[model samples]
Target: MTQSTIAAPGRAGSRGRSLIGLAAFVILVDVASATASSVTLPQIDGWYAGLEKPWFNPPDWLFGPVWTVLYGMMAVAGWLVWRDRGLAGARGPLLLFGLQLGLNILWSLIFFGMQQPGLAFAEISALWIAVAATMVAFWRVRPLAGWLFVPYLLWVSYAAVLNASVWLLNA
Candidate 1:
């Protein structure tokens, strides 16, 4: 076979491996954020158990599965963007994604770890905005990526309301 033909397959394989590596890195980042937020799980049974949650507050058992799915979607969404537009090209959208992820962790820390639902309400409101912006940015890059974030944005919207209710009821 010609050198050009032989080298083409090697380049394709290298590109595929790089894409896979990028996907793994994105997933690891998201998992790390989830793990960081989970540090407050002990307080869920200790402190959160005593809070005056709204009538609509979901059962504790539901949170784990719901968050697992949401985080998976978030990782995929981010990877899709980066896959389409690399880091430099997708900086703004990725930054928005990171902001929302950080806000997600902060909300848990404030509400569960610090036992400050009031402060968490403010943080989650900001998170909602960040998620919305990230969703829009992702949509601009890849429509499917944007679609993946819909559930997350909706969930955060609901969580924001739930947080406000809990804060008001307890305060």
Candidate 2:
């Protein structure tokens, strides 16, 4: 006779807890990325003061809180995709997500830390491309996850124009 094995209730509960832990890790990554960028803030502020900003540029106060919320949402979207698809399914999207995040970090370093507005503008343009590719990859697996990136894309689009403007005016 063939015997079937069943998962124990305790084991199932443990599995559920682990899944929650994984989701939390996604959130932590998001937080960590932002923290890394913000750690170099004094340098950014000093460089920013020298720039001739367009009148339409957003006030400095708005950036921190807006990014905080956006990063949280980004984390939730990643968690959702990870939960829906096992790690194997999530691999492609996650890779693209990571690429965009890296590009995001590079933008801050080039624009603010290095005080190179022109190069920063070029970097942000590349960031937009990475973000678009990431969004497309995420959409293929999870439509909602793709949708979650829309606000981020829009904000970055604005940022690109702002970067270009800064580069031009400062030049």
Candidate 3:
């Protein structure tokens, strides 16, 4: 039987707990991506600070709080999908989740670790696409889940322009 139709003794409680875990896992993934990408922070303090950034670029301090909330929302979105059909049931949605998450982490690595603004710009463009795809897929499974990514998509869109500007100015 499907998840909504299932009837069991402790299944509801069990799923409630597991869903929390799943959400936490998604948050952790975001944290890990941030951590790995942080290798570039030092560069930002020195080399990056020397580069010409657009007037509209946000202050560095704003990123931490923004990402924390975004990550939490992302986890909730993923968990909603997982809660619908468990691991196997939400395989397609989860796979899209994984794809976007990987792209997220990869963007940090490419941008900060490699110190290649142009390359990183291209990478973030792909990340934007991946995130959009994930959001669409999640929405297909659960409408609320899809809506959760709205802010994320908007932020990434802004980030893309910032990235492009930085690359051009630096080049």
C-alpha lDDT values of all predictions: 0.81, 0.74, 0.79
List, residue by residue over 1-171, the lDDT tens digit for candidate 3. Answer: 445433221234376666566767676676765675577577768877888999999998898788878888898888777766666667877898888888788777777778788898898888899889989988998899999999999999998899899999989
What are the TM-scores, per candidate, against the unseen true structure?
0.85, 0.82, 0.86
Which is the winner by lDDT between candidate 1 and candidate 2? Answer: 1
| Clashing residue pair totals per candidate (backbone < 3 A) | 0, 0, 0
Over 1-171, each residue of candidate 1 has an lDDT whose tens digit, in order, gives: 444323332233356745674678567756756665576688877888888889899999998788878888888888777766666668899899888888888887788878888899888989999999999999998999999999999999998899899889999
Candidate 3: residue 86 Cα off by (Å): 1.3
Give one digit per residue, the lDDT tens place, for model 2 in 71-97: 876776676666556455578887887
Q: For model 1, what is the C-alpha lDDT against the true structure?
A: 0.81
- Displacement of residue 150 (Cα, Å) in model 2 is 0.1
Please give the TM-score that candidate 3 achieves against the real structure: 0.86
Tell me the lDDT of model 3 at 116.
83
lDDT, residue 28, model 2? 66
Candidates 1 and 2 compared by TM-score, better number: 1
